[model samples]
Target: MKYQDSLQQASDKAAQVKLFLQRTNLAAHPINYAVSYEYISGYNSELCHIIEHKLLAKAPLDDFVMAELYIRFLAPANPQQEQLLQEASSMVSRMAAYSDVAAEQLDNYIQQLDSSMLQIKNLGADTPLLNIVNQLQHSTTEFRLSQQQMQQQLLLANQQSHQLRHELEQLKQQRLLDPLTGLYNRLAMQNQLDIWFSEQPGRRIAAIAVDLDHFSRFNLEYGNTIGDVILSKVARKVSSYVQNSGLPVRSGGEEFLILLPDVDLRSASEIAEQVRRGVEKLRFVSSRTKKTLPKVTISLGVSLYQQTENWYQFLGRTAEVLLLAKQRGRNQVANETMLAT
Candidate 1:
């Protein structure tokens, strides 16, 4: 009876996903479908409520918006991340305390050596002098042992600190990655921008904003599973184009951001064009049906960073250029030069 009940529940969940997809005119893609199924199953009440309200208001369930919802609500928290942070903090505190104690011990050892040397100068040239020399030797031996022990402790502490720092960095990198496309997310982009600005104040920064053409229609026709495969492929292709010189980020659903440092608008536009062509050349075949999928294309907008403008304004200008590309016709590159005219 339990097994039968579980099967029934699965069926019901699938039904609900289908119903939601139909009611909202959302693509029956895996990500979208899974989100819908989870909402109907009451797995994430917050996501369900937000989606319900959006649907009631007749909002478009575009890939970008849906991806945001999935990430914000459905992505599971990494317990390991929290544990690593706590361990790293503890290690830092312990190391600081250890350094203080080591410094104090070294000072005491130095004072003992100095006092012993003075006693040697004041002692007579007989048995008392010899005894003083012997006592000094013993003191030196003890000090050496203590120093060795402290050195060992310091080595151990250093190793632990290095390991914890590395782990924390890994966690931080993981946190800044988009789960779906294996690309850096917006948070990482912000960090990278900050680093660039701090390190090279006058360095030229360029942005290429890319949007997949007719992506929603593709999802509607081929379903989301195929759409996901295409999205990953396109992301990889775009990354390949700028792998050596820039950073590729999954900026939103069906959208990507490529940041090029030390590149001007012309160079950036060329790179964007290369990415556009690369994506156009990609061919996806369904593993299940062994059929070729439709051709995919991307529109790109290129903009150079202005020294006086903030990062948001820089990105906003790039987005505007991208919108112009889409308006002019899809699968083209639009740059700030065109905007100037």
Candidate 2:
């Protein structure tokens, strides 16, 4: 639609130029020169319209206007070298004729004027024409300054826009992160797991529910503040496990969840057992305690996320298995269903 409008505008401008030339007195040299300029402007505008349609169709307003300005400034090039040579020859001939007429007219005007009138016309940098010329020079200088200032303003605005985009992305990451544990929080998991589950079908999935074994003991033995430190330690260990396996998320206080994307019950159980044993062997040394702390363990339950399973069912099943693991022993792994012989 915009291209069509540009074409119509070009056509209308051409028609206007034709009408103007037809009414003007071509016997006058200035009028003929003006007509020639009009033709050149129209031809250049046609090319500008074509380029605008191709390269700058979706470009912003400033870009489009700048492109047109550049095109209008340089409009006399011919694609054919021979044609360009001929056009140059014709231009030279026309310019020579105009120059000759201009020189003759200037000589005549000078001869007709007296010394005083000639001095006024010459007006060496201090008369009315000189003052007008000075004002033009000043205005051009001021215009250039204004353009430079505007360009600086645009650059600053662009930098600010880029910074704002970066900060927005950072804010999104912060929202998905667990500040205390330096792990993905529940909100992140909800989105990540949903996308992962949708991509795979008719495949075995494993959800491992994890909880710190006797976590309250830390608060009882040391303090609530110390318990938080233990939680952070536990979170680090789970994150390490996820780096080796998949992603681990801190669901809430003292609780974490691991997702094994394509693992069946047996494979999931082995992974769960490894995590439990890994925690049991871990020795946490604190700033207060010179010696390594005593045994640490976590109970785990592994379950598959079925195609028909919703987020609620998958999580609920894993939670149920976790309860079974806790009841069976303090540190053990339980599966979604008992293995068949």
lDDT of each: 0.80, 0.63
What C-alpha lDDT, on a 0 to 100 scale, does residue 190 get in candidate 1? 69
RMSD of 2: 29.9
- In candidate 2, the residue pairs with backbone N, CA or C atoms under 3 Å apart (3 or more residues apart, or in different chains) clash, namely none
Q: Which stretches of candidate 1 lie over 4 Å from their true place?
A: 1-165
- Which candidate comes out best when scored by TM-score? 1
lDDT of 1 by residue, 154-207 (tens): 768767776776767777678788877888886678678789879988889889
Segments in model 2 whose C-alpha atoms lie over 4 Å from true places: 1-145, 198-204, 243-245, 289-291, 339-341
Q: Output the lDDT of residue 332, model 2.
A: 88
lDDT at position 170, candidate 1: 78
Instruction: State, as a TM-score between 0 and 1, how close model 1 is to the true structure.
Output: 0.59
Residues 1-341, candidate 2: write the lDDT tens digits. 21233666667765665654454322323434333344435555654453344232232222222322333343335235436545655555555455455555644544454344446546665577767656655665575566556556655655555565465557667756777888876557767767765786465667888988888786788778877887888788777766444778876567788887767779778878878877777777767867676577898888888767555556766777887888888698888784321
TM-scores across all candidates? 0.59, 0.53
